[model samples]
Target: MKYSLVASLILQGSLVLGTRDLQPVHFKAPSALHFRDIVRNDTYDFGCRPIAHPTEDGQFTLHALLTESQIAHLTEEYEDTDLSIHRPSEKRAAAATAPIGSGDRFSGGTIAPIGLGTKASGSTISSILNVKEISSAVQGLVSTYGVTTLNLPYKTFNGATQFAAYVGAGTDKSQYHLYLSAGVHARERGGPDNLIYWISDLLAASKAGSGLTYGKKTYTNAQVKSVLAAGIVFFPLVNPDGVTYDQSSGSLWRKNRNTKSGSSGDSIGVDINRNFDFLWNFKKYFDPSEAPASTSPSSETFYGTAAASEPETKNHVSIYDSFPKIRWFMDIHSAAGDILYSWGDDDDQTTSTTMNFLNSAYDGKRGPVGDSAYKEYIPSVDLTNIKTAATAAVNAMKAVGGRSYITQQAVGLYPTSGASDDYSFSRFWAKSGVNKVYGYTMEFGYSTNFYPTLTEFNQNILDTNAGFMDWALAAISVGLT
Candidate 1:
């Protein structure tokens, strides 16, 4: 009876998901442009922002989280067109999602979270870390490995004190050149785990004067030390409030819990990834036709009240100011299985230096790929360095004997505004005398599968740890100073 009611309301195009499950659906279109039309609508949730992946049949596949009503609406709308939508059997999908860790796995900051790099083959993580365990895991490292944790300025909407950890560079903040962050989108499980465990491996291996291995991939003591010397500063659990809600309710939540906009389910949060200060005022910065980020509070890609409006977004931006010399930055996300690099606002062009994001002269002409209008300008040399680092990360991930990975320009399937990678890279051009930081977004695991099975969870740690290994080494090769 409830489902029938939902279906009826969906036909009227007025019903929203209220404690209902979000079905995972895939839409295949003859060309990628068909997705551009879908992206403009504010009702859908594209995992960590949509990027259309090419299928073997010469079509594009976009993975989305939608209600049964939304899927039914799209099914009816595209029935006569070349576009098609599909969902797997509910029973099969129901059992495959991995479980979230029920108790504090870190035992309230006493036990360090060990990664797959140190475990035997086929070993699995019991579950994804609970929200409190994310903090506990990092604190365990402080006592065990001499890690320093610094508190950020802003408290979350829930009044949570956010903190970041930096090691190997000592007390001088400017000495750190590599920065990493995870859990920006709360439901991307294992993102914080991947970073924390990798840091554990680096510190442990350095202390023992040993090597680290992730399945078939291996890193020597020298490689580990080189990456450590680059000085990594990590901000894990950017949206603890949202994560706690998602873990407790199993709602697949993807934003920070801020109620200033709307105070109910599906309308209670802002996407931290989309709330960054780069091209954040999408209506003014991007092409008028493009919905690079949504304006609606209920939308998954909502840009929020203003640029860097949410405390999570502000805390992330403040990291760069605290560490002025950070030469490389990475924001970890999941389920896309690719490593993405900068200029996500539009197609990247290496020729015209003046046609960049800061110029108000090209304000209304910035998006739309393959057009004669303005494309985001990137220096050819900078482009090469980003591409090199991106390729190295994905290559090492593929070499882990688990899955194949690829590198892509961040703006591949659809353009995005205010994304972390673009904001990191834009700082070099937007600010005066700041270090030029090449930004990257690493999307790991299966397509749209944020909650991995136990096997995939273990595999994700292996794949990402190796990827981080090569990513840091490649950055060092490109020169940190």
Candidate 2:
């Protein structure tokens, strides 16, 4: 007896495949940590804010942005006691005094589109609208399916809620479970658009192909509906406050608006990504002043006052905790074509097996090891030779003309704390006692800033959604079923 496997490409509310069978395949996780040094250097540079010329007393007034602990650590390591440090306030004032139009200044940009496309007049492919409009459009496709909302409350913003919509078999005995989310970072244009279009297409396709497509490789309309019927929840925007702030105030807003720290001005929010509980405060380099003002409120890269301090972070944690059956979760981002995996905060010293799994999944072909002399200076996780499954997914995506790279946390491009993928993995291990929960952070598209040409933007969304769903479905087929 041959069992047929059907995969549905759900975007634009349409079914686009026939049925096929699951082939015997071997998958291994990645072991090597590449791009670690580059990330480490970036983090270091973020801490190093060069000083202006000499101060009033003819002494060079250097501003050390590092925390007290970081300063202490550096001092002990390098024995540089002569260095003077400035407080967060002084730094803020200095930054403010600098001209906004100055090339050296870091001006917070905007993510809002300069023009709005009317529903009927706008191109079907690219148009960034409010959440309400996106939601209304999706309702047309999955109206019959039960819709359950997860109201994630926000404290910083009055009565703000992070929205999630569930469609499929109602939380009971669903064969294939999938969780879809976008806009974890508000500035990413692809997040919201991809989510809305994917849902719409999935529904429309399922309706049109009810019985036309079938089997393992190809999905029939019925199979597509069954997958949806099995249960798929869509969280369109995870960081509502951050996204709203990005649109209205600053395009560079990466954290939530929650003021956990007691400081006023510049340092007014926590990098919600760095506010998770696992390996909680493990900074690659020691930086005490890096700590948020009140341990609650922060300006940038703030790791909340404590674990789960921000409501947005809590909302994610709660969702993962409440749903044990959620086998797959993807936290979407943009600007980089990356599909990052678990243990992001720090190295998972205990879980070498997980690292190996990731390595193999990524098909570990070591890059040029750029500037080998500088390689040893990089920080990286020590693991076996196996490649990461996340990397494999990225490679597969890349093989098809998708640009991607596997990077270590704190050592690749950016070092972050309290990420959703890390949090979800921890929660999964705790709840299920099994570390099979495959979570990823997908950075979609490189050419497009917040607003790319509609055609290019739409295609990028389609390709990414396709690649993601394909890998996800394939991974699920191989691992889960």
Candidate 3:
């Protein structure tokens, strides 16, 4: 808390966040007791702020990207405490990571990106979709499945016109109760592929009246029809410009390609995920000790100049206006295997309705983790529905026969502001007469392993597709209307 506040003051001068050539590393903390203090630093980047998972013996393992200097400083400080840091090598990263696709895989929208679930067993995806392939795959979906695509009103800084699609909902936009999206973070590769392929599986299975199998987890023809009947509205590839830069430069870029903030280096773009209107002005809504989102442009989680400032964020928000009855939403991302629920800016509470995000009574008093000051109010029914749906998705991911996943509230070890999941859920209370929507984030793949190997990429598709199936099924079970 002390370090974060001091850093915040220094940032008042509009200093650019310091840049570094960071490498992913694992820190085995002595226990969650020690891990909590370390994560509260706010200076350290625990990718997506997931809780440190337990090791077989008893210790907790945390993943982060750190510069050599930061690593050295922490090493010196925590050497006596047995806080061990281990560098990972899937044969030194590059060798293991699947290459980004060089040319159009979808043949300029002529062919759809078929998912692994629809193919015979032992299928594989050759590479991560290139920027062009991302669009072409979406085009293929429209061409092949009769999906409706609408051009989002806002154009990105790079002059790209973004769009979103809706399918399996017949003609009425309001019938689209379930929403799934991806490519919010440029370097979280395969997220778009995971969502696109899952859509294809649903369409194909519904057409053929056959079952869908993702490894050991299988959905019958009836289950497939039921999920499709729930309706799906998806915006795949939310940040096109960022994905373009990340794909071309091989940099771990996580923001839009907007240079309004700064012209060069890390000063280039805004973190679109952190630009949502929910608690966007973290300095006003959160406590001094909490750094939910950074004010520095060069920081990866920069909240941007204003809420919904970026055109991409506006396009994302525009979806709710178009499809007002959306009851469930899931934003897809990678490198952290978690299914995150609502209340990212603080802990969730069922009793304190007046202390919620929509209530100005708790301004400047929120964001502390274990505190008595304020807690975000979520009704008991809403909490049960979200948790039940999250658990179903997590169990389905494990049943895919590849890996395991956990479901938790979005605020795990630290808080965040303007995140998509929180903003989607907060809409009900923040705006009058808005439909009640349950929001979720599916963080797939290995921790900090942004560029998964081809094997892992294919495995990720299977794991997440099964997860989507159960998530949507559970959402329907809980009630879509």
Candidate 4:
């Protein structure tokens, strides 16, 4: 899909031309732009948008078509600010001031403090895992577990390359009953981290003397061994193209890279989250022209030319279809401290008992009480008692730290469409006759203009990993028993 060229006049003396490509378009400013005015007014309307190319130079050059006044405003607003745009007071407020101690035998260095070590090695597997490499790696895991790999086909945005992969269970296919995936949102820093950490933890726990227990629950090595005895199917980086674009071109990129024909040549990406098949067109019904569109290739909320148009989306769907036993699913992302549930559009809808069960297993059975600052900034939805796997994970993280965080649907922050969790839940309910599919969207932490320092980055990963381990093992215990 490709878009026609278009132009629009801006508030001040600025002309905006829309073009499609991986590289962002550059606009020259006549004078210095002010930052204070821009931030106050939300100039540039900077959220997430699509770009033409995936390169550092390509990203740095792309400019939002803000007017001279807006540019001037932003220049001044961000000139002296650090990458995070976080004020010193805000940083201090968000910081964990109280000391974190390991209880009893768990005290001292044995308890790894946040960001305790150098960032974990091999965080950039996306750079290494191409279609061929990913396929080979999955095959190796499948072979080791003595299971059959379900071959699935997918198509890319360019339509030039096709993606194929195999899915299967562990050594004893009957025992290994879960389907696993991560990196659904290419732009999120934690998506890849979650995948890497998950695999590492699973492998370590599989070893004879790893001593990794499933959270607070006491599971014998034999039981832990039984859980691993039946293996999992993983698709770590489903959207490689988007991931590459995010890392190299723009941090705010959110959508498949497919181009489409449209009025504003500028808008040219589909919100893959809104591209799923369930309640899929809600965005179109509400905003119609703005997003969730049946037409308009350049729309950020484009629901694909039709459902499953993008290869990446289809590949994931195929994974679900092939693996009937995938009782649990999780799609990881970052920045938002949220764990959203199904029926994201409304708060009154009822979720399955299994989903509710897992939600409790994951989110400590209670809603969070926001911190002073967060209470002031966060809305009520963040405090809602929603049974969602994502919220469960957030509650677990909070339990360990004694901090309060939000848990609700993604729509509480912003409305999204075709999200993987939504799709997974719908499918699980339809197929299993039981909502055994406990799906979640884990938002790690903020990592936009400012990437976390090495310490902050490491801490975020470890905290999330520990939280997920506790949640996963507990859920498994409930399911098996």
Best by TM-score: 1
TM-score, one value per model: 0.94, 0.59, 0.93, 0.59
Q: What is the C-alpha lDDT of each candidate?
A: 0.86, 0.45, 0.86, 0.44
* RMSD, candidate 4, Å: 13.7
The positional error of residue 327 in candidate 2, measured at the CA in angstroms, is: 1.6
- Report per-prediction Cα RMSD to one decimal: 4.8, 17.4, 6.9, 13.7
lDDT tens string, model 2, 1-481? 2232122112111211211111111111121222132223322212211112223454433222333455555446534333433333343223321011112111121111111111122334434545444444444433443345555544434357565667655755334356667766555665776665555545556545632211112234554565565467667776767665555443344566665454344355666666776545544222332221123343345577777777777777655445546766677766445556554432234423333212333222111122221111111321211124455445545544434433333223223445666566555344445333556676666411333445546545554645454545455444442
Across 1-481, the per-residue lDDT of candidate 4 in tens digits comes to 2232122113111211222222211322222122222212211422232111112332211223343455555457556553112223455335542111112221321321111112233332212233234434444444443324554576667552433222223443334445556555555554554444444444444554443432222334454455454455666666666665554443344566666643333355666766777556543333232232234454445566666667787888876555555666667665444455544432222333343212323222111111111111122232242253454566666654523445554444223446677577666435555334656666665413123444445446555664565455555654621
Sort every candidate by TM-score, greatest first: 1, 3, 2, 4
In candidate 3, where is summed lDDT lowest over 10 consecutive residues?
Answer: 11-20
List, residue by residue over 88-181, the lDDT tens digit for candidate 1: 6676496676778777877878877776666666777878888788899998889888889999999999999999999988889998999999
Better of 3 and 4 by lDDT: 3
Point out the higher-scoring one by lDDT: 2 or 3.
Answer: 3
After the best TM-score superposition of candidate 3, give how far the Cα of residue 424 lies from its true spot, in angstroms.
0.5
Off by over 4 Å in 3: 1-20, 36-43, 89-95
**Per-residue lDDT tens digits of candidate 3, residues 1-481?**
6997777556433332344467898889767556666676655666655467777898888888887888898888888777888898767565577889888978888897788777898988898888788788889888888888989999999999998999887999888899888999988989998998999888888888888999999999999999988889999989999898777666677888798888877778988888999999988889887888888887777789999999999999999999989999999998788899987988889996788887777889988887889888899999999999999999999999898899878887578899999999989888899998899988999998887888999999999999999999999999999
